[model samples]
Target: MHFDTRLFIFIIINIINVRPNFGQYSDDQSYLSSIEFNRGGSLTNLIFSSPHGGFLGANLTLKKLGKSLNNETLTTILWQLPVAGCYNDSLKQCVYTLKDCLQSNNKILSYHPDARCVIDRSSTLSMYLLTKAIAQSFVSHYHPYTILNKLTRQYVDPAEDLPRGTFLLESAIRAYIDYHRLIAIAKEAIRSPSRGLFIEFVFHRNSQTIQLGYGFDPLYPSTMGKPSESTMHELISRSGPSVIIGNNSLGYFLRLNGFEYVIPMEQSQQQRQIRYRLSTYSTRMHADQRFNAILFSYPIERLRKHSIDQEAKRIAKAIEQFIQTNNIKILSSFASSLLSVNRIMRLCVLFLSQSFTMLYISH
Candidate 1:
């Protein structure tokens, strides 16, 4: 059998030269269908993430870390675990999968019942709907990249440190890595000389007010200080502190849109006692680079089914106004088109490479 050495080399070269298609959307089913990535049109430098909002459960049994707590206390302490199914009898343990519970005629309750399976409740139907709404709001003019984790937080918590997040589980580790990899790809898609913004959503039932975090100390003074000390230093250096807390700030816009309570108001107290700071493992790691990060924590009330659209629109508008006021340059249509072309070229190269390899093997 004769092998075409020249053709084989050429195919290998093409495969090596092809860059990853960062501009293309990714629904990576290979990693147990844990992550969903929505590629931006490259029109905007904004990236949104939901680390805790996930629902799908895995086969791995839930591990009880540290002291033992009852089902109600455990669910309450871990805000992400949603109620899957409930058992009426105290002697009977709840089942692992929602389907199993449903088949057994178990009741589905949010709290105060023995749950057989508990997934991340944070990604409730309303939150998912809100993400869609925000995506649509930016579709016409400025599109922002979005990354969501689909697996239940019970198995993997991508926002936490690897040890705590994955609990050394092989499957959980893979999902965690994929989650960050998707975010990194999204960032690459929007790579620019100017800094970008990363907004991560976390739902909290404790506070009615919307809290925007920039990695500052919860009690840090609201006044502008050393930019180098905060995670948003790059953004602060470019646009100054006013872009974050002035009349044209995102908080200001949220107020204009009828959100009554927002942290870091124009006339905030000398000591800002924020409850939730964007200091999560993932947020800190990402914010240390070319993107400014904000941990957006809002009351779960905002995610109510009836008002999610309105809530999302209001938040989207606030982000838009913030970008405009800060002079953050969005990618031009021409640049976005170039990215799309890059994706197509990469796909073609990969296809050709695979076909040639198969043909050579057959010989």
Candidate 2:
């Protein structure tokens, strides 16, 4: 019996063309239940992620060997429960670790007049609201992809490298994996032949300034900096540092909208004294030729209950103005066209392969 070369080629082509559905999560029930993933519209090229804002505790299970699954052991401080209290009456300063909190009769005591823990709840909520506001600011069909971790930082910090982030707990490890998988899926969805932006929302309580990190060193001059040194080096090289510190930059728009504490402005004094330069694992690892990454560090005050709405609107407006000025949306459209050209090329290749196979069979 003669081999059916045409049928084999067709089968190979179909298999090669098969790709994961970028719009949805894996069909596994456990994966679907692991984290929160908000799917974006096909027309939008924006993605936002909140890794530290989750407060849900993971119900962890140990392996048969009684060992944490990962190679790195858990930090000693992480083993102890976190506390929201001062270590002693004299200091009157609240700490994050239980070892630093006041202990009376073997019980950790809260010492601060207003007990508060280092959690990212406010930042998470603010990001969610800001995403909605941004979508509203755009046309009806455009929406951004969002991923939020539900497990608290105590159990999992998806923003960190795996071993430290999960502490080797089985459930926490699964959740961490799910969080990143969702981000990858979202990125794939919007990268219509490679062009998009990723924003990560982080929180800091020490200052009320809004820090925008582009993976630059905190000590580096924001205005007169070298583009090649940044994580968004490609973008900076193409658009110039002006995109970051020029009159039409995000910092400028934010300042124009009454946000006095925006950092990395053109020749701003705060650029030298105060800077976050949060070249986090997420931003460093995810930024590539396909998409540019930025970290938005918001102070707790901006996301407080009384001000979250107004702050979200202000941020949305600034972001909208920045995008318009930079023509980022136009770049996204160009990327879509590139994707179409790629698809047409792939179809032409398949047709040529089929025609060659048919000719061989006829001969």
Candidate 3:
């Protein structure tokens, strides 16, 4: 099948409708003026993110929440749970570290006080930008600070005290709302005759491996296109063992990338079933078995582990290789093609429009 212009148009319109409103305010003298979500090109399912690569604006938000490196106030601390990191409190903060938990001093033991690590996910934003610029493809960034700010409400009111389970409940609600927004986009894209694969990008501070996530047991409907096991295995093989490594790329990427992973409450067998049950709401929907959500998580300390530019190039190349190797089809020709001149005109129009969208969206 040839390129499906209709499908492409549908994708573009959806993105434009949801495009973050960063215009008019562009001349404003704040980094907040430039911050946007759902930024990237359209017509592809490939998505990338630097969830933790948002330190600049994040610090601003922290300061607004009364965080100060000098005096001890109700500081907003970026901390990782003991289960989330491979580092001890004694170790210097490394690149692979992701401070997922957001807590306030008012909340007793809401998060580990000593495990705070203020480093951004290093060069993840730059890495993602490089891939998008070169590939001319779509990517997304989940501003960790924005998400966490909404979760902890520290920026809104640093002194606002929350009960033990209140913060967690609010976080889960906010997460689901954002996640469903993405899922809606995917569902619309999938409705196109040329269904594309939905990809999520992430960073893992403790490892320098790319983890892949796709497929599901027969119980659920797939949300993205279904990529076979052989496709995943082959893509992994081509990426080389050194390029692919991580414990939970799918889970982490989903949480950060706006596709929060969900499991059926009835099937959960954990000890804290009530707590888990409270967290498991309709918004925390898992990727159905049909939708193929492939996750790519790079090492956090990638700048020090290796050259940042090289790492970006390697990952970008691997992604293209995976798409082509899997023979993933995303478009189809319509009945009775137009004349050569007409086709050329259509191509030119599409490119011009796409370029314009990318120009504003990528900022």
When 1 and 2 are scored with TM-score, the better candidate is: 1
Per-model TM-score versus the true fold: 0.66, 0.66, 0.38
Please give, for residues 1-363, the per-residue lDDT of candidate 1 as tens digits: 445677667755765655423445555455565566776653668888777554333332333432222322221122233345445355465544322222211222222324454544544545555665776688644677777765656567787666457644667777888878888877886755546888877656656788777666523454367666666777788777765677756788889878888876665454244445545667778885578887777777655543777888888888888778777677666766666567667766776777778778987
Tens digits of per-residue lDDT, candidate 2, 1-363, equal: 344677667756765664322444443655323466766654777777877664322222222212133333323222333323333346664443323432323232222312444333322455545544554555534566777665456566787666445544566667878878888888766654546778777666667788888777534565336665565665676777776777767778988777888777766465677646456678878888767788887776665554666776687778778777766653355666666566657766876687777778888
- Model 2 residue 5 distance off true place after TM-score fit, in angstroms: 20
Clashes of each: 3, 0, 13
- Would you give me the overall lDDT of model 3? 0.34
lDDT of each: 0.64, 0.61, 0.34
Preferred candidate (lDDT higher): 2 or 3: 2
Better of 2 and 3 by TM-score: 2
Locate the minimum summed-lDDT window of 10 residues in model 3. 142-151
Model 1: residues with Cα > 4 Å off, grouped in runs: 1-29, 54-123, 267-274, 333-363
Which candidate leads in lDDT?
1
